[model samples]
Target: MNWLKSGFELSFRIRPVGIALAALYAITCWATWRLSVDQFFLPAGIRVAALLLCPPRLWPYLILGEYAYFAQMRYPMIEAYGLGWVILASACLMPAVALIIHLHRKAMEATTEGWLLSVAASAALVASALKLGLSHLLWPAPPSMPFYSNAALFVLGDYIAILTVAPLALLWMRRRSGYDWSVWRLPPTLAALCSLCVLGALIALVGAHDPMARALLQLLLVLPVIALTCMHGWRGAAVGVPLMNLMLSVTMPTTGLPSSFDQTTFFTQQIIAITSTALLALGSRITHHYHQQARPAMEVSQAIAFSRSAHLANERDLRERALGLRRIADDIEAALGETAHLLRANGHEGPATDLLRTFSSRSQQFRELTSRVYPTELEHAGLYVALQAGGLREAWDSSHRLVRPLLAGDPCQLSMGLQLAAYRLLAEAVLLLLEEEKGQILIRARCGRSGGQLGIVFTVALLDRHSTLTPATQGLAIERLSARANAYSGAVQCRTNRIRIMMRDTPLDSAWLAPPRDVSYSSETSARH
Candidate 1:
């Protein structure tokens, strides 16, 4: 018994289509009974309601339900328009409506201007016309039905039904399937506008007012629909469309709704809302693209302004540094002058004069030291000489066991900032090695010119019992060295205990060889002399 139960459950789970068909047939029976027999609630009279509540694949089942109900209630007593006629009529009209919707779907995918509007208008008109023709041929007309006497009014009513209902139905189904309800949450302003529009439409409907006012109100609904499209996009418009239709139904006359006239009006309002929603959503999207493109230009302008300010600040700092160096040079010259005078007056000629001379000599040395230490020469000398003078020699000797020149050739020209950073890195590595207890390190540097670029490698070896180093202390020195490599649009990498930094050099004009000197000499030097 348990095995049979398990098999039954598995069979039901596997036959999803069967389960759907069964459910649809059951609903159709209920709908037909309600419509032709009881005249209480019927899918035929409220086709939009049926569509919204039921699935598209189940539409034919509802039609079948209509046939069964007609046979049971009205067929024998009133007429003998067989089930075949009803089926034939539904087949001709239903396919046209479905095809129109399908074409509209294709149009929406086109991503061009006016495509959505074309889709909405064309689909709605075709659907309405098809339903009007079918209803005129198949169903009996009554005095209560709107435009029952005129073929044009019937088409218009049908057109309105398809246009108003279809798009909204499509949108609602999509949203429900995705389980998103954000469309329903309207902003206060939009909600207020929608409310006012509803009120105006209500007044127009109630007062049996001027035909022009009613027509104008009908057109005005399009404005709010477009506004909704702009504010909330297609999905929002879809939700709003159905809501507007429901509002229209409440205001308009209703005879408990399975009446042919009531169903036609309901369908028309639904179609209008949906079609306008699509039109507005598309317009909103186009407007959004225009705004998106403009945003980047504004950001770029702000960025340019920020960069300009930074450049000015840097120039200012360089000027201040130049001034400070001049002041320091002047002070040293004055101190040397007083010492020279004191030595000459005391008559301690040989020793005191030597001391005075040394003092004066050091002042001159200070001037020269200052110039070389902060020279623009490295930009010309490039990375090679910069490293030598900047104290990397000791590290190179210990790490690579490099007793002789580690890098030698025609100048390895590189960017000024890169040259400075590389020089600093090598110097730091040597210092770190020297601090070690057993402190013997091997360093090596190699330069290669390849593919219009220069590559340099520097490595250091340290002897420690524990080979592993902490992350904070380990390779941090090399990591800093690597950043220098990056400034030249190159890379820095390290493996095991070896750190390698490589950069490519750019071809330069002869003018770069002789960078012009911009140094200003101290005028105060003459006074000290």
Candidate 2:
């Protein structure tokens, strides 16, 4: 097993070897999929999965293998359906589906759950529309069904196929290093097995001959999906959808099931697709919400630990983490945005219309939280703008305290590290002082040559002498300020009615003389270019 793994790993690295391996693998999968079950075109899923999982360079090999596999069937198809029909079949099922999904990979990578499933479903629709459109228009597509019936099944089949395969392929890539096998937990496992057992029993009792029983069984398939999704989020649907599909394919008698000439199957397949997509999206959101509620400190520690020896962090890393936090806000905000849908679902039309107006801004409060996690605004707007603008100012305004000459110095001159540390210090200090319900705090800063070193000194003071804040709370604030200041080897001081935090870092170089408006320009500019 190890030797085979090593050989496969090595082959994937070399250009020609990788191409050959991908092609051969594609052909083998295509053959096996064709022989597996005739209920659905599993190759459609494989074709879409290739685009979802592999890079552009590896795409041609997979497409070529699929084309070669279809080429064998093409000649026999021509003998039965004539050369023109055969040509149309080959053309419709070309590498174009790969291209369609290739473009959608970006939308799939988007942070929103709706974006992930909606875009992918749309891609499947587009592909199926392409294939079904031409084939239905030109020839009588099989099963002795109407054109509309064939088209519905065609669309639903692709949706079912793509959902079954693409998400699992993505999940495989997303698992952490050496963490692939750990994803299957006991709860989801038991839920999946129980679902399979129930489905098997349903199939045995109904006996496939009864159309109503068939429809009933198909409808009940969503129960397992709901259970699994409640248990494990998107990962649950990834397992359960495919598992249920396989169970239904193997257990149900495929040939004699006749309801509206098999339109019942199409209707049920659409339900399954919709159910899986909804489950994946909602499950992912719920999972993220719990994760955010649970691991805020872990996230902060991870941010600090990810820091490097350089003056500033790798901007990509910072941006990624920042966007990650922003996405938390997005998910939280999405709940509001979808309130209209919920209201509509519950049949509350009048208020649903009104609720859409403020739905966009409902999560404005979380902006402060996201900003605190990683100050992405610092990349574009400087330190002072970020502080003075958002929820950060509430610390002063709400408590009925006035900070005189609230901020000073050229915040842009401070190194990125100093600026962020200073911001956190100021934020923490303001938060601590706000406990008293009223206290004045002043932040004063200077950036330039301090002896032989180039750095900045920032001071935060509690101007109100007659405040009720405890010394322990004050001490904790100082400790946090000190932690932020540690990167600059700066100072933290606590007086009777005040606290002072000073920080300075990186050499005072020519660049510090007239610092640009944007502190982290090197990374931001390069990234834009």
Candidate 3:
């Protein structure tokens, strides 16, 4: 059975003849129903679905089948209604179907939801109006029924058929065309089963004995339709609502229905249409709200992750630079020592001694510059040593600057990137204060877990009101500090004479900082005094 079904589906996809044949079969089967004053019509569903699903080329086949079916059904009415009226009624519905197909093509994409109700409603209104107007103009009414009543019944029946059946047919065709069915979960299925069970039990218990109970049961049937709409969106309501309508049509007594069959069918169809529309609209609103909320959070998370990646890359580059500098310095010292010894052996003690002193001085200066550019102390000891290097502590001891460390965590636990960023930010801040000729600069730093992120906050503020710092100078300082902070997924803020910087403290693995072995800096060639 499964193999046969698979083969049939495969043939339907690969063979155009198979599709045309299927359309003819469906149209012929559905269009056989007798047209009456009050009963719900079925061919409208088949017609609308076929128009929507079939290609434009295949429409000829659908129309041909429809015309043949209508000819057979209208043979008895031909004497009273005329052949032209039957042809007009059969052809009038095509315009409404075309309008709906236009709308569906314009907006029916996978992500779009809740449009089913509007399309169905529009199709129903257009089809009902056209069918009703043409019926009145072309067909003679029975003596027992008024023109208005018959027109109303015609419109209501068409509207009911289109609303209840067309949507389900469209959904089935969509599924057959390869729409994923996994989105239809357990909730709608449970709601549908519960609705069917409740409806069956109610019909059996009432059995036309209690008019009030039957009416209440009809109303209660909408519960599952509402649930289905809310849970599985419009597709659920499309299928569930139509199934409930069919159940009610089969179980409920025709005489016990509202004042007349037309009134009851109209009222029932209207209730389902309105209920489904409201539930679907509400579901769409809620889905949109959640998407709106999640989009920003996702963007922020991505931005942070990107910043962290760039920060790690920068850290690796800095580490390689530091390693290259150290290697160059060692090579230069070795070459200078060898040159001095060879010069002395050639009986040039005076110049050789002078060259040795000069070499020592230049080597020390090179080390100082390398330390300032990439703090070796910070890498080995921590931020405290790096901040205190190069007379920073002496300036504080002289009361020329005020440096205070409020660190809370073990600096060794932090990533090398974080430590480097913190050291650079502090150094820049202190330099800015000195450049502004401030009497004193207060430095405060603390590191610990805050809000699930292990991080540190370092702040620098001027103690004197007479500092020479301008707004532009402060802005530049803040900008420089922020650049460094952001390298470690951190932020910087400045106000007046004060600047604060925060950074994430998660320790990065050393393997990520491995230097490229193919690149080498020769100390003797690259080093300069």
Clashes of each: 20, 0, 1
Give me the runs in candidate 1 sitting further than 4 Å from their true place: 1-84, 102-105, 108-150, 172-190, 193-226, 260-529
Q: Please give the distance, in angstroms, between residue 30's alpha carbon in candidate 3 and its true position after superposition.
A: 5.0
| Residue-wise C-alpha lDDT for candidate 1, range 322-380, written one tens digit per residue | 44775787876677567667776887568767876786677655644443344334556
TM-score for each of the candidates: 0.38, 0.50, 0.56
Candidate 2 deviant stretches above 4 angstroms: 1-39, 112-116, 136-145, 177-184, 187-192, 201-217, 256-263, 288-295, 301-529
Clashes of 2: 0
lDDT of 2: 0.60
lDDT of 3: 0.63
Q: What is the lDDT of candidate 1?
A: 0.47
Winning model by lDDT: 3
lDDT-based ranking: 3, 2, 1
In model 2, what is the error at residue 481, expressed in angstroms? 12
Q: Which ten residues in a row have the lowest lDDT in candidate 3?
A: 520-529
When 2 and 3 are scored with TM-score, the better candidate is 3
lDDT of the candidates, in the order given: 0.47, 0.60, 0.63
Model 3 segments beyond 4 Å from truth?
Answer: 1-95, 103-118, 130-269, 279-404, 410-424, 437-442, 447-455, 462-498, 503-529
